[model samples]
Target: MQIRDLPYADPGVADARSGPRFLLWLGRNQLGGQLKALAWGLLHFCGVAGLPLGVGRAVQAVVDRSGSALALAGALIILCGVAITLGDTMLHRTAVTNWITAAARVQQLLARKAAELGAALTRRVAAGEVVAVSTGDVEKIGWFVEALSRFAAAAITVVLVCVGLVLYVPELGVVVAVGVPVLALAVLPLLPRATRRADVQREKAGRATELASDTVAGLRVLRGIGGEELFLGRYRQASQEVRRAAVRSARMWALISAVQVLLPGLLLITVVWYGAGLAQDGRIEVGELVTVFSAVTLLMYPLRHFEEIAMAYSFSRPSAKRAARVLALRRTTEPSGVEYGRPSGDLYDPATGVLAPSGRFTAVVCGDPDAAGLLAERLGGHPAADPDGAASVLLGGVPLDELALDEARAAVLVQDKDPVLLSGTLQELLDVPSSGKVSAEDALKAAQCGDVLDALAQASVDTDGDGDGDPMRTRITERGRSLSGGQRQRLALARSLVTDPEVLVLDEPTSAVDSHTEARIAAGVKELRAGRTTVVFASSPLLLDRADRVVFVHDGDVAAVGVHRELLHGNAEYRAVVTRETEEEQLDGITAIGELAVLEEIEESA
Candidate 1:
């Protein structure tokens, strides 16, 4: 396939059995590109090998004073040059095409897996590793696949060159043949050590890359906490470690390169020394000596390809393994049957024994946020990891995981606490691919995003003071960094509401907002989702009071289920978790009042 028409309809199931298997799979995937590259590579090497024969014939013709033979040899040499030019150009083009296509295929596969796994992908693989695989690892894999054709062509040429020399002059040919193999094989012993060094360098580089990525992602937070210098120092140390590892790796590879060059040069010198002795004994012709010498000199070029191929394999093996790991991961839920599931009754999690009734707001109070996140994911039928043999969440007596992915997604929308707001216009962020049941205005109102809309409108480019600004036109910075925490949260809520799923699972949706804003949002959510199944995981009294029922999740299981008032009065565990937050707010209020009184006294003294 062409580069422009990339992102194959089916990237095809990867052969993740091993690193070598994965590299072979990538090669097989781009067979057409590889074949084209191979053909050109063969042509190029043929031109390279054919040159020595033509030069020998021309020299003999000159020595014999045969004008006709000289013209023929000159024509052959020119033809080889032309072939070399065309072959080299086309070979490079095809090789690059193979590289591009192979990389694209891997990227498509990784993207598909990312979509399937969502936030789980990052959890399963470190964010740095994923980043490295997608970028550097992908390129390395493509490089190896592309290099295979050239490596093959070079190897074949070396064999052919040695065979031709044997046919032309057996005495010299035997020595050349035996010596060439020795030169090639001698460097093989040092390769394992070099590869080990390379692996160490790669590992350090990946860690450094991950650290840099994390530091950049949390740059805003670092600045707020005045910890930029601390992170920078950490990164500096990481960068230095990577540098030292790279230097060690380079030194080993340099030694390998030195050996490869020195051995081949020694072989060339030995062949010339022996061939000169043969010529002196009248055993071989002058033309034959020239041809053998030129062939040995040219042979050095192809031998270098062997060194490159080894290096390529060493680097790409780890990369392919990482890519394969990502490709092999299966979504936690396996499709059970053909039928799509829609819960007509209560949404039940058998493991936790929590029932979120249909057509009502249910607030889940999980003592641990991690546990709550896991439960929320399970409820949505998209658990990040394996659910420990627990039965799939059931809705209306239908297994959630049994439904088609689309159907399951349509049925439940779980908004995690750390929701990302993609960089785009406000309209684009809300324009999610889903059933368009909820209007933008309705969702914004329900999300209590009036203040958010105003702030966005003020930041919008088209703020002409006409008083009827379209907040949708506002451009959100990456992850909505330009907006406050509460604004970003509200915007995320609005986007979720726009989807209007069957069961809306919100985890700490209004955590960043003030108590008053949280209360308004709590009421607005209840109003907007009047007859829909809404599950809110929270500990705030404002949100819990509005819930139709409150399920207290303590120590990993459902401990109590009742209305907000009943739970507050009856369950002490529930009361403490909820009231403790409120008590802190009251204490903050008292502190503020006392500070204001002190300021008033200071003003009176002045």
Candidate 2:
């Protein structure tokens, strides 16, 4: 976990049972760093505890007219300084290491979960919550982790100081030994209520953050509909609620701090007051009383840690819980090692009775958009779920999920209706790992991205003359928001084309484009993917007409299958679904046209 050490080959597993248990797990994982911090903390606290003894002994020696009191005190002071300096420096080093290592570990775990679950992770958790846990929550967790050892060291110092006082001067010692523990433990009962208040505050804050994120993500749409003020008012109300919760939480914490300060002050007064009575009775020396007073005052510093540790734990517990929720997710279609799915065969969906041959274009037409999407997801091997007696899609005869994950993914790619183009340079976005076969230029051409390239080129101002007029180097804004609807869709289609999978499933890939451009894109895709398996989920006549096989889905099942023109002539249901027209209505329109033409000829003859 040190800065100089190499990266981890394995980031290790996490325990996500509960907040406290996860905290304990983090501590255990970073035990070496924790021990380093603890050792340094011990040295530092011991150094501070030794200071009063040196001062008290020097005072007593001075009172007795000793020859070398100053010399002994000077030596002890120097030794304490060295110990304190060494301990403080190393303590900082190790504590920060623990904090950073813990945070990095959590981030890695989150990244691993994200990679495993892909886009499905966000469906199961709030986007804002995921953002919070990975950023703010991780730091709070690390803060608690680093604080634990320091608090332990402080507690031990308090105990040691009290025991020394009791052994040296019993009369005043008994007072401190009893008073310090009470001061530390008195605030415990208030912690629960305070922690609850803190939790409420966190919830309110999370809601506000989520609102802000959503409002920002849809700012363009909000402005188009003139709903800025409405969203603003909603967010304002959420912000105010957070403020109220925060204030409530602060009040509880304030009460705890007041107790912490008040109780310690009372203890100090008791020690001084009682030690004076002992001096009056000649039970202890003045110098010993001075020592007793200094030691009790010193306890106040470490006692502050008690409050800090409480606050840190309160803040980090909820954070850990949120993080645990995200880390607990598992992919539904786990990869299989022993069984490999069929490499080259028709992709068959048992639910829809649709089979895409190995080297042909297939189009699916469904009246229900939602059902089409679910079927598309299933065809891509990322099904929503598997209920009892449900059949899985198979490549050849083997189940899709039975294949290794990489193999299944390599076999098929489903470009959703609304695909996302990540923020980056155009080149980086197209540089997918599995895209060695299809060149970016070729894919872009097939996707009819000529205007998209021009738009990107116009937006980019290349500093070096050598980089001029090349669209590949154009930088895209986050989520491609800077591009128009059609331009974004074209770019997404181009990006997906470059993947060069064995089977490409596109759901309405050209729905956002103009009819002319969509017609060209349909033709280009047919030419580019001539010998590969390509299934398009679309009802557009231009796209459907290009398919070698068109399967019309009715009521969540396959109703008809044929070439687009053949299906139009042969299957009335398919015609109605694709063209939004029925047989009798179409006949009536043709007869009405004939009657209008006949009346025009009669008027000409008259």
Candidate 3:
């Protein structure tokens, strides 16, 4: 039952089974890698059923003149060519190691259901259907679990070559045991119309891969609103409705491959027209009617593996029911096993009169950037509110959904103001999840980032200089797109102040820098986060004047709290919402005559 013990199994009895009973509960939880790839696919289908019993014993040793029957038909055609090349190389190395261990156990059960729905798996799935169920529904559930060991070694080599042609020649084994079960149950009534056209071509290829991953994650806000040819003509009409549902699921798999080649060429012309009238009525003998017409032409090669295990279980049962509805999303409140000990120091909320208290540097100041993104998802346990109601939030005396997702992500760390700068080195994006606990020159000197490490050491010595390096060790593109939005918000607030997280939070984190690099990042984040538990959010009056506490909020609650000049001399709606001072007095009355001709050229050049 490995694959890390199937994520603690009983996700409520895997939500009442189905998708072929969750592939028979993943072949009864990988029954020893499907019984060692079904015993090397029944010793590679008994070496392809000894190649039609060595071509009907080399055509019954050339109609038996019997002089050691052509050296026993050249030693049964060199032992049927060394048992068809050792059963086609152990049936393609045990069916490609049962399709790479059933696609590495459905990609380790969709990465343990995306680490048990962390960040609530993109609010319940559709990040292009979890990137098309982690890549084409994990290769169509490892091509129907390695085509169930070559469909149980092609149904035991079509019942041992129709019981050895019904004991040599019973009317050509009753026309090959009644025409190999009518050409393997004639594509089982066209497999429920080719599995409902391959589940409408896998739901129009997961809605054309969720409209091309939402038009490439909103191609830079749809090309800054030109709406990039209206989202590239709605992703070219969802890729022509996924190319007309993949040409109606390839016209029902080309009419099930033209009835698997016209029912095995009409059962090899009814076993050579009734075994040529029982070999001219001698009651079968021309070497047992050429060994019952070469065992009905080797029962059409295991009835074409019963039409390829009915087209790999009609395209892996809708890609294992879209990976079992993304491992049945959960989290509505569970982690109560305690252990969120350290926080005891301030970040209360109770709907609005926010608190923030702990080690200091609080800020908030909202004015509705969606109520500061729902108060940074209720101060980062990411969603589970209700700490005794009234807008609820709290941290000191614990409650961010009773902690535990690794102790509420190791005591809070939000960051987010378009943070996500993933793909690689600026020292591996400030060595995320704390590898080398924050170095890169103390997170680029608390993120003032010495001119982004001298412009990545002059673009890595103009793209390659033999100099032994330290171009901040190169690589950063992705969300860092080679730098700037104030160097990706001061390298994501210097990788969250190199995870000194006891409770960092942030949100605005110098919303795109400037005001003298947001007053040297509010005094280098109050001197490299002095006594921890930060918060910040920001309406940037230079990070709310280095906040010891600010609050403000509004319609969603906490209309005012303290310091930023005591809420600009006692909160007149927090000084008309953080001194947009009447839009800077209507932009100083439309630049008052170009500010008095730039004050008469600074008093006639002084």
Sort order, TM-score high to low: 1, 2, 3
For each of the candidates, the C-alpha root-mean-square deviation to the true structure, in angstroms, is 5.4, 5.3, 21.1
lDDT of 1 by residue, 1-606 (tens): 777787788999899888889999988888888778888988898898888888988998888899998899899899999989999999999888888888998999899888777777888888888898999999999999989988888888889888988988899899899988887888898899988988888888889888888888789899999999999999999999999998998898899889988988898899899989998898987778888988888888888889999999999988898899888888667777777545566798988888999998999998888888888888888766436778788889888777877778888888999999999988999888655878889999988899888887776635565545668877789989899999999999999988888899999999999866887788888898888899999987778878999999998789999987777666667766776635564544443344335434543542
Per residue, candidate 2 scores C-alpha lDDT tens digits across 341-400 of 447678998876889988899999998887787778788887443333457788777788
Q: 2 or 3, which is superior by TM-score?
A: 2
lDDT of 3 by residue, 101-198 (tens): 66776777777667655554765677888889888877887788777877787787778777877876666787787778877887788789878887
Off by over 4 Å in 2: 3-8, 339-342, 385-389, 461-467, 570-573, 580-606
Cα lDDT of candidate 3 equals 0.71
Best by lDDT: 1
After superposition, the stretches of candidate 3 with alpha carbons farther than 4 Å from their true spots are 2-33, 36-108, 111-113, 116-126, 131-139, 150-152, 155-204, 208-243, 259-263, 281-306, 313-358, 364-408, 415-501, 504-532, 538-563, 566-606
Q: List the candidates' TM-scores in order.
A: 0.91, 0.90, 0.40
Estimate the lDDT of model 1.
0.85
Position 5, candidate 3: lDDT: 47
Residue 369's lDDT within candidate 1 is 82
**Which residue runs does candidate 1 get wrong by more than 4 Å?**
218-231, 341-344, 385-387, 462-469, 581-606
Error of 1 at 574 (Å): 1.2
lDDT of 3 at 54: 58
